[model samples]
Structures are given as C-alpha cells and as structure tokens.
Target: MSWRTPADALRNELIELFLNHPTESLSGETISEHFHISRTAIWKHLEHLESLGFVFDAAPRRGYRLLSTPDILFEPLLQPHLSTHSLGRSVLYRPVIDSTNRWAMELAEHGAPHGTVASAKEQSAGKGRRGRMWASPEGGLWMTLVLTKPIPLSRAGELTLLAGVAAAQSLRTLTGLDIRIKWPNDLLLNGRKLCGILAEIRAEAETVHTAVLGIGLNLTVAREDVPALLQETMISLSPSTSSPWTKARVAGAILSALEPLYDSLCQDAAGFSGVRSEWIALCAHMQRTITVRLGEQVVTGTCVDIDERGTLTIEVEGKRVQVPSGEIVRTEVW
Candidate 1:
C-alpha cells in the first residue's frame, strides 16, 4: 500500500492494532475513537486491508479479529521484525519489477544510503552471473542490498562469498536443513541449487563506491513452474522442510545474519581471514574433486582451500592452482 497519505497511515495503524491483539476481538467503536475516524472509515480501511490478503473476522458485537496476514514482502510486514542497525532498516518493496539489482543500482546512483534494501515480488529481468537471466517467479525472495562504502575493487569478490555464507548459515539455522555454500556464489541444499547470489559494483580508480548484492532464493516455487532446463537442478525451500517460513521471516533472517559480517569486512578488509575460515567450513566443494571451466580451460582437481581474497585453491597433479574466477562444471566426493 502506498503510504503517502494520512489515510494510509491510519490504515496501517489499524492493522497494527489487530496484529497486536490477534486472538482478541477489537470493537469498531474502540478503533474509531482510538484513531479519531468514523466507524464507516474503519470498515473502508478493513476493505483495503482485505484486498492486501489480510483476513479479518467481523461479528455483531465483537468487532474485528485478525486471522491471518499475507506472506508478501511489504515494508509494513517486514519492518517490525528487523533487528539490524543498518541493513533492511529502510526497505523499498515492489509487487513486480524488472530487476531488484537494477532498481538498487538506480537508487545507489541517486545516493541511496548504505544498507538500504530493495525487494520485489516478481522480477522480469532478474540477473545471474555471466549475464544469464535468473528465473524470479512469484514465490521467491528477490532483493538487492546497496553498499555505499569505499571497498577496493580488488577485494570485491569477498562480498558474494560472504553473502553465500550468510544465506547458508541463516537458512540452516531457520529451517534445520544442511545448507552448503558452493564456492563463489551459489547455495546448495541436499546437493541441489537452492539460491544464487549476484554482486554488481560501480568502481572507478580501483575503488568501488557502490556495490549491490542481489540474492534470489526460491522459497515456495513449484517443480513444474521451474524452467524445463533447471527442473533437474533447482530446488525450493518450503516443500523440503516442515517449518512455515514466510518470505518476510527469511528476508529478515538473511539481513540480520549478513549485517555483522558485512560491517566487519567494511571496517577492515584484512578481517576477511576470519570470514574466509567461516566460509571454508561451509564450502560444499572443499576436499572434493571438481571440474571448473574457466573460459577455454577446464581444470579438474581436488578443492583444498579458499583464500581471504575469495580465490579457490585446487590440487592438480601435485601442484596447487589458484582459481580466481570460474564455474564448477562438475563435483564429486573423494
């Protein structure tokens, strides 16, 4: 809902009252006197809330009781649960957009502050690494976080890796699933792709002024809804777990998990060593044999370590090779 007018603000206030007393019935006269609006205005506001997927039970003497709220990623629904000082404190939400990354970049160009979050319910042109299109359906979390810090361009790769680690850690803790981070920018659940991270930065003179970290997580997408090519590889979260994780909850958890790590890296780039250790512990390819395709070269080796710079180390034919950037074509245990 566009909160540009006083009526919208009053409507939000009314919803908050119902949310605060979910089990108890609130009389319309009480709400009307509380908000200084007429009982007729209360009915009108409830209708507007109903259109937004809020279920209210109204009776003769007993007023209105909220039964359920929509799981959409609206600012009102998400703002109450956020505990971070920076990230997600100011949220801009859209029902449909071309890409959250694009929107975030635009905001950054206009001097949006650090830790501002832009999210969309559906993305028409969601981005993936290497200029690929990410399928951002309705039942997924598509958001971008804007970082307006002066991070050196050389160490920009750490953001994506740390983001993967944050997602894996938060999802595992929230859902009780074994979420693993594939080196570089992928999250895997049960050996299948569950989420992807794409980080874009605007840099000049070897320093980045603005970087947008875009994360796409499939939460409740169905199998058939997935593209045919990705059907065998991609997976969603809700179907695999018994917990009822709303999009707001997942989004809040990820931002909360990432804020401290991001702040540490921003304060001291050398602190990446500690974050690197955390990442390696969660790395899905560590100590496993994998084949990575770097342009024209395909290197198959056993993954050994990931350095502070977010480069992968592989043991190939008794020699250690550093893979600065590449895609893992295949993975095998032992």
Candidate 2:
C-alpha cells in the first residue's frame, strides 16, 4: 500500500479544517490542539501550504484565516474525491512541465506501470494534433494517462474516441452542460472548443506496447489571457455557467468517468462497441457538412457515420468515404 508522508497527511487535515470554515479564522492554538501537533509544526505546515499557492491572512491576535485556495491540482485535495479504480492510481503532479504527454511517454518507456497519471499546473510546450501548439496556461486541466497493456494497434483510434467520450460525459454530469464530441478527439460546448484529446501509441507490427492519452481542458482561463488568434474559436468552461468548479474536482470526475471505460476497452471487445455507439450519439457533426484537411487535400462532405474502427465516414459526391484521420477545418450545419 502506498503511504503519504506525515507532512502531507497533516497538510490535508489542515486544508479540510480551513475548508470547513472558510469564512472564520482558526487560532493557531486551536489548530495545534486539534491536530495534536506543536504550534511550530502548524506554522511550518501553513508555510508549506502557502508555498503551494494557498493564501492565508495572519494577525497578531486574530490568528489565521484562509484568504483563497490555490488553483492547483494538489493531490491531497484531489485524492479524497477521486473514485477511480486504476486511471489515477499513481499520480505524478508537477507545478510546471514542458508537456504532460511528453513526460508520461518518458515514464512509460522507462517501465511506468499502467494507469499511471501525469498532470501539471501549466505546460510550456503542450502539443495538439498535426504538431500544433496548445496553450496550456494556469487554471486548465493538463494531464496524461499511461496505458501499459498490449492491445491491437488498430484499436488505438477507438481508445482516443473513448477519451473524448469520458471527458464529455464527465463535464455533462458536473455542470449539466450540453457537451458534444467532435469527430475523433475533441469536446465542444455550444460549438466552441472546450477540451482536446491526443492519444500517442508505441507499437511493434500489429501489437501495441503502450499508449498515452493526453487531455487539455479549459476550466477557468480568463478571456483576456486567451491568445487573440483563438479568442473566437476557443472557450473556457467557467464563463458559460454559474456553477462554481474547482480544478481538482473536475479532474477527479474525469478520472472517475474514464476508469470503467478503460477497463471495458482492455477486457472486452463488445464493450468497445458500446463506446463507439455512445460516441456517435454524442457526436456534434453527424449529418452536418464539414471540411476535413488531409495534408494538401481537403474534402468537403456531410458526416454520415463513424465506422466500427472509429474511422469517420463522410458522404462526398454521392459516395461515402472513410477518413482515418484528418484536421476538421470547418463544420456547416444544415
């Protein structure tokens, strides 16, 4: 069994105490007595929490009060709420990283166990499909799930679709938002991009050795902080609804929703069929005209259906053409 450090356990307890009384100040003596720790230890623990971005207000006689909670994916705050079997069994959290996907890939290559998760507060070099740079500022969900189980290489595409489904379902359950999956690996809210999924796999011949599924979700990004080029195309989740959401809460929900789907995909082929059906039902572009860009070629057609292998089938020139992968340039609704 994995054990938490004494300091970490104390920190969590302190956080819970603060959370239980967000508006009230708790005296140092009270906190120390409650936890059965020395006043100096409480001070040290508070300092450590401050270092993790938690804000506290202190006065000579008024004791200490939590000013604000950090917008970080702290494991202590997330683990209690997480209801997943394996997806987030071993989480590696970093304050900042070049890319969670890159880090997860390195760990997988070095024998990281399956269901390990790598998450970061911010990613300096996040990437999307077609080698496009993804803006991963603070207050967004940037994480990667490492899958070590061996499966057919052809099933890799389906796994990517499954990640999209998990994210969409999780958001819908949390906020009651109208979330929809866009083709292979994107979740859209009211026709705007809310989340992006990228799946990378390493395979020999037809067998897969490992796969890393990376997801970037915009939870609380400010409108001004968004890049000017993507202001209209991209959106954050907080602005659309009045419901308050924390980064750790949303992250836990995503993991909880993904765990069962991951188990089904690895254990039963029939389970993948159900995933595909749900994906199709949640797809935003079905029967809609879309332009897909493949290298130098662009095909404009009406999206008819997605096949068993998760290939998009679009009707072009009275014929249905299956597009294994491509960039969707535009979607036109009838």
Candidate 3:
C-alpha cells in the first residue's frame, strides 16, 4: 500500500517540463498555468521538491529557477527516466516498509506483470540470504524487481548473476569504486559488503511463476550509527567515496545502468556474452584458492571458474566441485 502526495505529481510534472526544456528556467507561474493550478499550489510543489533534496532558486519576477536537483527519491521524479518500456511500466515507492521484496511478492500473487518494481526507504524486517537480517536504513536503496520471463525454470538462476553485474556497474559509475562481485550475488568492495541480492520465487505446479529480486545497497549509515561489530562488518557507499551519495543518484544510476544488461539477458540467453564475462571480470577472487562454506560442511579447493548457470566451480583434489547459488557462500572476507 503506497500513497503519493498531490505535491509529488506536481513536482514530477515540473521536472518533466524542466528536463524537456533543459536550457530554460521554468517559471513557477508558468508551471502553475501549464498544470492548470494556482501559484500557491506551485509554491507547495516546489517546497515538496526541496524537501526531497532538489535545489531551485526563486525570485519575485522569475518565479522559480531549477538550479540543481538533489539525489533524493521521488518516484514520480524517476518515472520518466526509468527507460524500460515493459520493465518499469508499474512502480511503487514507499517511504517506509518492512521489505520491498515481500511487498512485490504479494503483488505478484495478485498477478503483477513482469518488471513491476517496488522500492522502500526503510525495511524493518529485511532478510538476506539464509535468513540473516539486512538492517535496511532510510537513506539506502531497497528495491525488488518482480520478473516473469519466458525462460525455462532451469534458466531462472541467471538472474542472480544479472543482478550482481548490474549493481557492480552502477557502483562503478556512481562512486567510481572498484567494486567487485563475489559468486552468487554478494557485492564486495575491498572485500566488504557494499550490496547484496536475494533471489526468490513463488511457483504454482511445474509452471514457473515469479522471481523477486531483492537488492539492498548500503548508502549512508555512518560508522558510529552502526553497531560496533557491524560497523566493521559492513561497508556503505559512504566509505569508498570522498563525499556522501544521495539515494536518488544511486538508485537512478542502478536502474539506468542495469536495465540494459537485464534487457540483454532476457533477449539473448545463449549469448550472455557480456553479463557472464563482466561478472567474472568484477569478481575479485575468481579462479583463486578459496574455501566454499555450505552450512556445516566446508570444502577447500582452488576456485576454478563459474559456469553459465552462475555456479561457482572449485577444483577439489582432482575434480571440479560445483556449488549452486542456494548452497555455498564465501566464508573468508578481507
């Protein structure tokens, strides 16, 4: 359940107008007239935009000048820039929620289409792989993309790798961090978690149903705010960058950058040429000696390679041992 303020709509309309007329300053009075609203209504809209971190200049004669837009999220503000026709045809944004993935799953059960997206500012009960809690704070990007592709059930596992590549590309673009992807969707930066992806599905009989791609990227929790051990355990966009990263910029970069990769994966299955190759390129410890931890059982082997199914292959003794997404995790982190 999400609600959008009237101010949100007005703000988006103004953003569309401004982006359309890039060089010209959009006057507040002109905006109101264009939207068939009042001057005071325009003021309220501008105030709301400011609250969302957009910067604008206002003068008595000129009305309002769109100077620079901040990186805070306003779904309507991001709607136009979503870029994908089928993917983001539907999107829901919530300022606070328990889990965007859970919400998206519920929507899927009710027959949401492919590429329907749900995002939240806070997740009180965010869950990572193996039921570990993901402490989702307000200033981070918490999103779930509900996907229903035509691929066979066996091919579904590729989404995890797809997500990792997308996230890595976005981080590289935004903060210029030399972020890497560990096997099975753990995003690593200097060997610390910068982002994580949890892929889930709901099926009815043998027919494939839905995939909830839950993604969480740590953005702005300073060290002092985090619990002592977690402060050392987790890393955010704040640590690697010289300055702070706003939610909007990070979110936009992720969607804009990743949408194409996702498009490619959906279009070309055998030719996962870029996605597979780039994922391997971003992995810090690819083909290196490392131990794969699968529950109580631990397997020590040389990291040989990753297969097309996104399985990590370990060279054990004389044979190659393959660990699937749901089974193994990297135990060692630097």
Candidate 4:
C-alpha cells in the first residue's frame, strides 16, 4: 500500500492547472471556484504541494505564482508525460524504502497487476546483479516494475537485456549522451557506470510466477552522495546545456520505451532476437578482449555476440565459449 488519500486527486488537478498556466498567478478565489471547493481546502492542498518541494509565491492581490518545481519523481508530475499503455499505469512512491524491488515482489505475489511500478527516493538495501549491493540514495531514480504474468524460466536473461536496451535508448534520447550497455546489466557513460539493472523472478517449480525488473540510475547525484569506494568507477547524469532533465521525465521516458518491448517479448517469441540485436548495438564491450570472473574461476575472451537467450558468447582460445552468467571484471577498452 500506497499512502494516497482522496485529496491527492484534487491536488493533481490543481497541479495541472498551475502547469498549464506556468507564468500566470492563480488567484485563490479562481482556484476555489474552479474546483468547487472552499478557500481553506485549496490552501491546504497548496501547502501539501509545498511540502513535496513545490515552491510558490503568494501576494495579497496577485495570488499564488509557481516559482519552481522539484526534481522528485512524484506520480502526478510524471503521469501527464507518460505515453505507455500499461507500464507505470499505477506507481507506488515511497520517500524511503528498503528496496523497490523487494516491495514490488511482495506486491506481485499478492496479485499486483502487471505494469505496476514501485519507486523510492532512497533505498536502504538496494540490490544489484549477483547479490551485489547497489548505492541508492537521494537524487537518484530507484524503481521497479512488476510483471504478474507467468513466463518461462529460460527467458529471464532476455528480460534483463530488454530493460537494458530500453534504458540505453531512452537516456541517449533524453540526455544526448553516449549511454552504452555493458554485458549482463550495467549501463555505462563515458566509460563509467551510470546505471544498473537487476531482474529477479518469483517462481514455483520451473515456471516463473512474476518477474521484477529494478533499475537504479545516477541522475542528479552529487559527488558527496556516492560512496567513496565507487566514486572513481561511477558517473552521474548531469543536466544538459539545453535543459535540466528531471527524475520524473527520465522515469517516464524509460517506462514508455520498456512497455512495448516487454509486451512484444511476452507475446512474440521472435521479439527476443530483435532485442538481442538492439542490445548488441548499444553494447559497450562488443568484440573486445575482456576478463570475466565467475567466482573462483576467471576467463579471458573477446566478446563475440549475445545470443537470443541472452547468453554472452565469447571467443576464448580457439573456440566459442557461452557464458550464461559471470561478472565482467576487467575490460580492455573501457
């Protein structure tokens, strides 16, 4: 459960009205008359918006003026920009949570609908691939999408790749930065990590009951916000020269790109092949000599291709080695 109240709906409408007239001041009398509510109710809603980081300027005669809006991923701010059919239709936002993925998995088990999204401003126990800990803090996008439909266990890897493709494309379009996907589940920017994706499955026997896809991006993260150990290896998405990209806009873009690809993969088998090609195109280490660490075992090889099943095929020694799961610990070019 979300903490949404009946008042949020009216507040969302009020937000829209202010957004439409961004420069003009909205008089309390006009707002109350438009919403058919009392002046005190409008003031309360405005106060709530202020608490959520919306700054307002009020005058005796001129009324309230929208000074600035925060970069937070509030659902109402994102809803108007979203163009997806199902993905992110219902978003559960938390100021702080253990993990969006953890909460989303619990919701999926309890029959949460497909395309339900969970997000948080900060995550205490955020996850990464292969049980690694992700650094999730304020000024970042920590989110999860729950898929309620059952899927075959074999296609789990492809789902992660699909998410990578969606994120890479969206970031490139939104920021015009050269965002690349490293094999497995990392997004790189300027040879440094900018985002990570982790896909978890809840299943009984061999059938996957639910697939939870979590993404964490370093958008608007300051140097002090990142852990000291990862400062050198990670990069943040800074605002472009043209305009600042808000967390809500970035979230909406990624979700919009993901929903159709997800539907295509679940509905059509051939869609995985297309996703594989896109992943390869956006891949950061294709055809490069790299060393992968599989626990105690390590293998060095040239990245060849990603198969339809999302296996990273490497040319090691004289033959092709299929790596189903491993960490690319070292890259030659990056």
Cα TM-score of candidate 2: 0.83
Residue 313 in candidate 4 has what lDDT?
89
Residue lDDT tens for model 1, 84-161: 888886566667899999999987777667888888888998999999999988889999999987777787888898
TM-scores, all models, native as reference: 0.85, 0.83, 0.78, 0.86
In model 3, how large is the Cα lDDT of residue 197?
A: 92
Pairs of residues at least 3 apart in sequence or in different chains that clash in candidate 2: none
Backbone clashes for every candidate come to 0, 0, 0, 0
Instruction: State which candidate, 3 or 4, has the greater lDDT.
Output: 4
Order the numbered candidates by lDDT, best leading: 1, 4, 2, 3
Q: Residues 1-334, candidate 4, lDDT per residue (tens digit)? A: 5334467557767877888899999899999899999999899989988987899999998899888877776666788768998787766667789998999888776666788788888999999877878989897899999987666776767888888999999999987888999988899998999999999987788677788999999887776777899989988897523567788889999999988778777764655687777888898899999999878999999999888888888999989998988899999877
**lDDT (Cα, tens digit) per residue for candidate 3, span 38-143:** 8787777777667656677777776666778755455555665566666655566666788888888887777777777788767888878888778887657788
Against the true structure, candidate 1 has what lDDT? 0.85
User: Residue 195's C-alpha lDDT in candidate 1?
Assistant: 96
Using alpha carbons, what is the TM-score of model 1? 0.85
Off by over 4 Å in 3: 1-11, 14-70, 79-83, 88-90, 109-113, 205-207, 243-245, 271-274, 326-333
Q: Candidate 2 at residue 129, lDDT?
A: 86
Q: Which stretches of candidate 4 lie over 4 Å from their true place?
A: 1-14, 17-45, 57-67, 109-112, 239-242
